[model samples]
Target: MIKRLSLISASVALGCIVTVAPVLTSIYIADEDAERREQEDLQQFAAKAVMRTELVTYQAFAAISDMEAPPGGLCSATQIAQFARVVFNYRYVRDAGAYGGGQYLCSPLSGDVRAQHLTMPPPDWRSKDGYLLWYRQKNPLSNERQDIQIGRNGNYVSIDPQSYVDLIDPARRPIAAINVETNTILALSPGADADDMLNAWKLAGQVNNEQWHYAVARSASRPLGVVVKSPRSSLVGHWPGLLVMWLSIGVVVGGVLGWIAFRRISRQLSFPATLEWAIARKKLDVVFQPIVRLTSGECVGVEALVRWNLNGRNISPEIFVAVAEQNGLIQQLTDLVLDKTLDELSKLLRSRPSFYVSINVSSEDLRTRRFLDVITARLQGTGIRPAQVRIEATERSFMDADATRQTIAAFRNAGHPVYIDDFGTGYSSLSYLQTFTIDVLKIDKSFIDTIAQDAASSVVAPHIIEMAHELGVEIVAEGVERDVQVEYLVQRDVQYGQGWLFAKPMGVNELVVWLSESSSTLQPIHQ
Candidate 1:
């Protein structure tokens, strides 16, 4: 009994360790990720602020550049005042004037201050040629400190620092702008302080501070730099909630491990179980590939393809569909594909009554009544005619020959067309054409792809088309991506074609735009 008690204690301890280690590790990683994202966001914000400031500065400079210098080499009082008024109309320009001969010549606010012998202060920030300068000085009218810029030809434009500062989003974080040459604070948001602002400037491009994080980006067009600062707490505001979730997960995992130590339980679940979860959450989506008429190059129909977005990754349809079919989940997947296709294409179908959308179905889907019921229910009041919906099944999907034939006949009786998809790649049995009521034969991409490579080896596609034509079935050549391929299909009298050359698979909104843009040039198939 003592030995058994010791073993139980050891197992419980090991389980707790196993459970706690990962939760703690995940929390640490989460904190690090949050910090990294915060730094990146701050850098982006600073870059944008600097860019906006530079644009305003450049606009003012451009306006000044357009003004011709007075003929007498000194701007008259009237001309200076008028130029200043034009500059002041811009949002960022606070005042404007002309300065020459170490004297203030004229200004819109204080015209002709020539007697003052005004001295132009050495610029806190200046261009290489001393053409553009930004400095701080007292406003002659308001008698308050102001930031100003001087152009090359004695034209001066004062800047409203408040306008530049207000461009930074105050609700995001504490931000400030400073001159790189003079180390002067050009502007600062309400919550920011001089001490923190200076610290942030020093800590630019670094995130090692324990109390505060800093990001800075200098404008390429000017000498100004923008700094974004945030307290460590704000950077990791979600840490507490993450900690609670991790703790709860740890408790549950530890209990499960401990239970497994005593009771032998199978931990492996089937693929269908996971797939069922995905289906329940509606993680399926549909994309449409246009089918064009070769002669007129007009889109006549679209093929609906289902996509699986699982865990932020896209899983290929071939792998998932095969697994689903083996595990008896194909019916559910097919039903979902049908519902999503009809719902998405309903608008296009209603607007263009002649347009058709094809949906792929598996052998299992054809064998069951549930598939037909799903299609019927989804199209009841959706403004989609029964004929507008086409069913496409592969040659192998006809393995249950009787059931597939019955389904196809029933579908045809209800005004829906059934097409044989991926022909010449699958079962490729001639009996499929003779036995089932196939309306369209879509030659697989494998055959169409070989048409350009080996003329002799690619003879199968033409023969297939001839045979399909003899049986009164329309031909659709898939993967027609080249001009040569289009010419070949049109020459062979192929009715419908689809490939990336025309358009790749697109979402509903993109299809609507494409249709609107191409409608004028598109013509219906001859027959």
Candidate 2:
């Protein structure tokens, strides 16, 4: 009993150590949560500030646009100049000017000063002593002609004004001008501090570094972004408390359980689980899912998903793949999956030359020269065109954005299509969509699950479809279950659909029959 207790203690300690590494790596020393919360609060504040300021600026510009030439109403050149000056002098406004009939109607109000127009009186003002000379000279060396030099025949260029106004009919009213300025409406928003808000904006902007900022830029009217300027030290400041909480939990429950587990397992029992041993032991298997075309009922592809047979039980790929990855056996495991998947695919390949098979490519495969040569050889041996073979990748593989880009280019150069699996769920989703020459974006099942229920997803589903359409990237919705989900995706014009809605993953013969039946129902009628 005493020996068992000691063994238990050691096993618990080992478990604690193993679990702590990943969890602690996830943890930070400072109060990032608090800082993030603070940042979010500041962003809200900033957004509110922007909206308030923007509305005020918009109103100001609209009012200025409403003003006509002054006799009975707010028209005189002096009045226009003063109004421009006053609007420009407003806290957010940077500069203001007015133009009429190809001449400066009034001096510009830039900074704190206002300069009157040299030719507001027109013909009389144009012919005066310095005026005639001003008209005669190629370019006058005076402040009065600065406007004349810069202004086109009948256009006004207002600098850094509060808001923008453009006259609808410039041909009819030569004096009419359009006013546009930075507006800086977002600066007035309320919420988190500017730094935190900015950080959140930056994080959100970094959405896989795919250049999704253009979306925000296109939707610039929504001031939901922030530029975090806080120091890294500030970000980590609040993490200590959470770390302590976690560590305390670790020391008590985690440590005790780990020590027990380590003690129970004997060294003699921990032999290498060889591939041959696994296969002989019935520890290898494959799950096949059908990929169909969006517009028709054509079964264009089948993705071979590999699963590990563990001690007579089917273990999830998630568990063993991680184990293989952690133990430096990922390459070996990947080879096993690929070989098994391709061998299985070969049975279906002959009848389905048009049928494509997609296998996942790991970072390990991309990094190794041998892996690339092997994949190439396999493709040639199978008589599969480079385009027929698709290599699926996760965001992390692509997050080493530079390497991923080069790898993708190489794959494309070889004629195979590369797809981002679980797309739109990664850090650089937008960036990858924009930067990498990806052929297909397999939308994550998470988004699909919510599509039928979430309003946000309803808008987002169509938006993603439209954006992908713009980029010429095909959108494939995965993990679809219901008829509603399929119908929704079809309506949104998703390019491909895969999930239980069609059929669950099956074996070779079963899949062949399922494919034949599915084809009958989903066949395309070509004209």
Which is the leading candidate under TM-score? 2
Give lDDT tens digits, candidate 2, residues 476-518. Answer: 8899788777777777678688888766888878988888787
Query: Please, what are the lDDT tens digits per residue for candidate 1 over residues 1-527?
Result: 99999998787666666765554565576678787766666665665556555556665676676454543445566577567656666656777777776456677778778887767665556667566565556666665676656566777777766555564244557777777766667777777786767666766646466877787777644677777777664424566675555455654566675466435323224456777778767787889999987878788889999888777988898878877887878888887888788778877799889999998888877876667777787788787888899989887788788887888888888778999898865422343576677789999897798785643225457657776887999999998888888778777888888999889998999999998887776764333
125: Cα error in model 1, Å: 99
User: What does the lDDT read for residue 159 in candidate 2?
Assistant: 25
User: Candidate 1: which stretches are off by over 4 Å?
Assistant: 1-270, 521-527
lDDT of each: 0.72, 0.53
Give the lDDT of residue 492 in candidate 1.
82
Query: Which residues of candidate 2, in runs, are more than 4 Å off?
Result: 1-261, 264-282, 523-527
RMSD of 2: 14.8
- lDDT for residue 340 in candidate 2, whole number 0-100: 77
| TM-score for each candidate, following the candidate numbering | 0.49, 0.55
lDDT of 1 at 279: 74
Model 1 residue 73 distance off true place after TM-score fit, in angstroms: 99
